[model samples]
Target: MSAKITLIAMQVCGVLFISNSAFGQATPQDASVNQGTSASQDAELEVLTVEGRALSLYQGNGAVFATRTNSDIDKIPQTVQIITQELIEDQAAYEISDLFRSMSGVSYLNYGIVKMRGFEQESQVFYDGIKGDPFRTFTIPQLFNIEQVQTLKGPSGAAYGAGEAGGAINYVTKKPTFEQENTAELRLGNKGFFSGSIESSGPVNEDSSQRYRVGVYSSTEDSYRNNVEEDNLILDLGYAWDFSNDSTLTVQYTHFDQLGERLRGVPIDENGNFLTDISWNSNEPDDEQDFQSDIFQVNLEHSFNDWLSSNSTVRYYDTEEVIKFHQARALVDNDDDGVYDEITRRYQDQTRIYQGIDLASYLVADLGEHTVVAGADYHFASEDEVFYYANGVNNGVSNLSLTNPSYDSDISAYNATLNRDRLTELDQIGVYIQDQWQATAKLNVLAGARLDYFSEDYIDNEDNADNTSYNDLGYSVRLGATYDLNAQIKPYTSFSTGLTPQTASDQEDSLDGELFDPEEAQQFEVGVRSYLLDNILNLNAAIYHIDRKNTISADEDGNTSAIGKVRSQGFEVDALMDITPRWVASINYTYTDVEADDISEDNTVYRILANNPYHQVGVWTRYEFPAISSSIAFGAEYVGERTDRTTSYDAPFTIQPYTIYDLSWQTAVQDWKLQLNIKNLFDKEFALAGFNEVSGAIVGERRRIYLQASYDF
Candidate 1:
């Protein structure tokens, strides 16, 4: 069934392209209408006044956000998806993951972890086009101060720094506006959930040359999982000064405090059946994961002339995280019983502190028919970490029973011993340049290249004999072309390469002092984009293949090697339509196939990548009634079956397919707005494939309902 659906989707995509190409010889009136539609869409967000305020440094142009180029998106040959503030508000998204349902080829794992295309991404997230956030790995990303999100699919090493082949996500934060605006909101939900927030932005002086923005948010919730709850607080403050008509300087400070317990998921039997309640938590009652962060940033934008400009940012970050948890190591049967009776659990405690500084600057020049962008960035980061652990077998602790569990045991009884203490420092410098040129009346070409130098100094405080340092230089390149077939259709093709550096820790258990090489990735893509139905419907379709080499793996002796290879290919479609005066709808679908070579067997066999589905679909529709100033919306997501492939498991396990639905309503009266949302409306019971055999399967979210109220002044 999955293969059949994939075949049909390919046919549908081909047909759409063919039909649009055949319409290239349009009539004069049709061409004129299309020209108007294109013009209107191009100027949609160009001008901002009292009613619509600019949020970020690049929001005013609308031409450069994700790619950092002055060229329009239609002319760029990469797949870029943008989630607007209006859509974010309509969905009432609290965190970045909440908006993943509307994006193509994207999936949420846990916390800030995400899977794009077919590869898992943990450290690929960015902010304002810059890489690295101190707390990204420790805490969930809140949306209170974020203006929009841009998903750049495919290898972007040439434009950004080192990254995987899957893609990257950039969060555009809000900036100070010269217009006065203030809002206060409160929300209440089931499961002991509550939240409150306040935001204000306006001018600091009578001349409006100086602007200020401030926001405060707090929330607490007891999640669906047993013994899992979270409390969060966030604060943002920003000030901007227009020192000159063509130059601006902005300063911003942000702080975050988060407290939560880890959700390790429930164990499953060999038959792919849950061994206990889905909500069962393996962590102890006192286990907690806490994160605290502080960030300070400065941005400066200056126009050298009508044809040249520069944008630069310097940021400093400090963060700390502490965690203690119980992890299920493996399933065991005491006395050789046919049925699994005992589970090996490990208790662990860790503390880490990270500090970093990042600097990036870009110069954009418009030279006749070509727009050029050149930039350089520098990053310096240091981390101090300590770890302690105690395993059931190694410590002679009693194993927990699989079918029967007791939570009354004092966690202190399992005394964890010192494991490792480490301190590391990393420095990276990158330089890149790109040019977008109009080769012909209907042909646009883009080419870019980047070079990076990175060095890592690792020190094992516990044993200086284990210390190691490594440094290397790497390069990436990108080339793409787009041809406008007609007013409504454009076809494009691109080839790009990416690289990810290996840390010293990845080779801790290696033999012969053999260090691993950086992973290399390359992708080839072809796609078509169209504006149909007099610009009421927008559609984009693409097919791409990505190959990654030098993936790290371990051998039977626990020796690490970079001999693994993985490949992923997929077809995607995204469409947005205005069905009528009061109706709006959007749909996206993705079909992915991924295979990885078995490293343990010396790459003799290929296995399907676990935790990723072959087919996924998303749909959303909304209707508005002007009479009551209200709107209602419906959303649905479908995930196809997946396989759990791991050497520890005797055989491959299959995870069934599932679908989830959501509904929401919003209304406005005077200056007050009210909203309600029901997620997982049908309360479906489902589970997702986990990282490995030991991690087990994760339980899906249950039904949740919430109400919100906001007042504007």
Candidate 2:
């Protein structure tokens, strides 16, 4: 080991020893497994040196449940990416956003907006195939109880229900195991970061027919940006009972809480240069954003015979949120000299309450060389929202100097007006059937169809004249075929269609006082997968095209129409290789070209679509040293340049291209594992993307260092 690494390892050992003294306790498994003896040490080293490389974590060779089928990932014709739990641990990830950095065809924008395959996605994140949000806006899932994350590229409305046209993300949660196990972890880092978590799972009875698992995670952190701090708490509880050899039932509950300040981007010049320090704040310290949610789910599995089986799930979710902040309105050019001198800010207070219930069931039948899957699902939701603003226009806010920012504005005693008070209800039912056929020795065919019925009611609590009700029937279809050319290569092609229901808020945004039809999407994809060199390397590549129509659009006069259309085409390549017994690497690249058509001639929505990048790349590599029981990893990503604009006449600015690098080290001793991570190692000063005409660019985080220690027995 290098001298620098040696010193860091020594420091980590000291920290672990101190922590063990304060938190460690004797356990049944720990007492039986001794690591101090020479024989045990030799055995550990032999195991690591002989069989340490993990191809499953990097190659994604397992089955994917997001398809609601029994086919292996390699045999499926869709583009699916599986991020394993092992990778999460290696990276010491804290939240879902942390993992998105290495993902392909995915981008993160401000205000909880995530783009997948060049389209904006909301409420598309799922937990074990069940919907997680009614309209996700400000919060993201934590990583405490997640086992793996599966990202299905393109629209999945045929298997799943109503959603965005982009894609869907499914989080597989950890379940109760019969084997006894316990784990605890503590993390400390710069910028006032601290976190603690513990989990335990084992048999609940001597008969081993009952099992239980419980986990708790809490974290608090301060950001490099000014007036930004967040605290989070989560509890995961689960129980499983085996009724007989052919049947089992499981129940789970999760409670989540988060509190933080909602911030806007820092103002920038026309060239995308920061007008002030990246740490500058446009909100007050007293501003706060709070969110809480509760989820309960039950699942049952039964097997009538070797050829037939069934799985069912039911879930209920409720969430509440409150947000109060100073929102940027616009930039003012007092001199009209093509330079901005002042910025306007407004006060906003909003509250939301949402509840939903979902039920889904599917049966699988195996007949000779064919497997058939049939499923049905139902969903219902209700939401109430209220908004309070200082006024209805920019006059309610004051102006601040572009170079000098102040947060002394107080709205405690100011009289605010109710801008909106509304309630919305949604009901949906869908049924789908899919069949996978082994047509011949080398060809496999898959086909599916779905029919969905949706109903929606929007009520204006403050204005009875604005109430509206609507319902519709939608259909989706999928067809695919895969050909096995040889033992190491397979080629596939697929076609699919999808539809999304327009939210009540979106419908209300129309200036013509008329609702539009639901949006529709169609996609065509072709890909190939290969395994070479005795399964030491894996490569996959794909090209796809998608078209979506009936999008909402507004003209310069504020008149709206459902005549907008979008065209998205992309190419992606991913590879994983084992260079040596102790070395592994993964590389991925994405090229996306998205355009808009049939929009209002005088609108800027087409220009705003340029915010999505055209090219992206990610790489990760790791190497292990058996003698020291340590491993090191390096990661990097590049995002292509994009355009930032808010209106048709606004002068657009260019967001420069940038790259960020990360490093991590992990070592194990006895029953303890320690990890140290350096994010943004070079402290690159850059912006993610622009929010609006005047809100400036969202600055990226500076360099950060954190260490995590975990104990498992």
Model 2 stretches with alpha carbons more than 4 Å out: 1-54, 333-341, 391-398, 504-515, 555-559, 601-608, 645-651
Query: Native-vs-model 1 lDDT?
Result: 0.77
The C-alpha stretches of model 1 lying farther than 4 A from their native spots are 1-63, 136-138, 332-342, 393-404, 507-515, 554-561, 601-608, 645-649
* lDDT (Cα, 0-100) at 562 in candidate 1: 83
Write model 2 residue lDDT over 1-713, tens digit each, in one string. Answer: 13323434443454456445432233443111122221232245422211125465554455546467657776687888888877888777777777876678887676556778888877677878877553347776777889888888887877886787778888888898777767777788999777777777778887869999888777777898767888877889999999999999999998888888877778776677877778877677778889899989999999999999999999899998888987777778889998777777778899989999999899999887888889999988888899988742344456666667666675765568899899999999999998889898778888888999999999999998788787888988888888888757989899988899876667777766677788898889999988778657777898999898988877767777788899889998887878886788888898988888877644346343756889988888899898998999998888888766455466566676779999999998987899999988899998777765567777877898999988775
Q: Please, what is the whole-model Cα lDDT of each candidate in the order they appear?
A: 0.77, 0.78
Instruction: State the lDDT of candidate 1 residue by residue for 441-487, as single tens digits.
Output: 78999999999999999999999988988888999999999999887
lDDT of 1 at 276: 70
Candidate 2 has its poorest 10 consecutive residues by lDDT at 30-39
TM-score for each prediction? 0.88, 0.90
Error of 2 at 630 (Å): 0.6
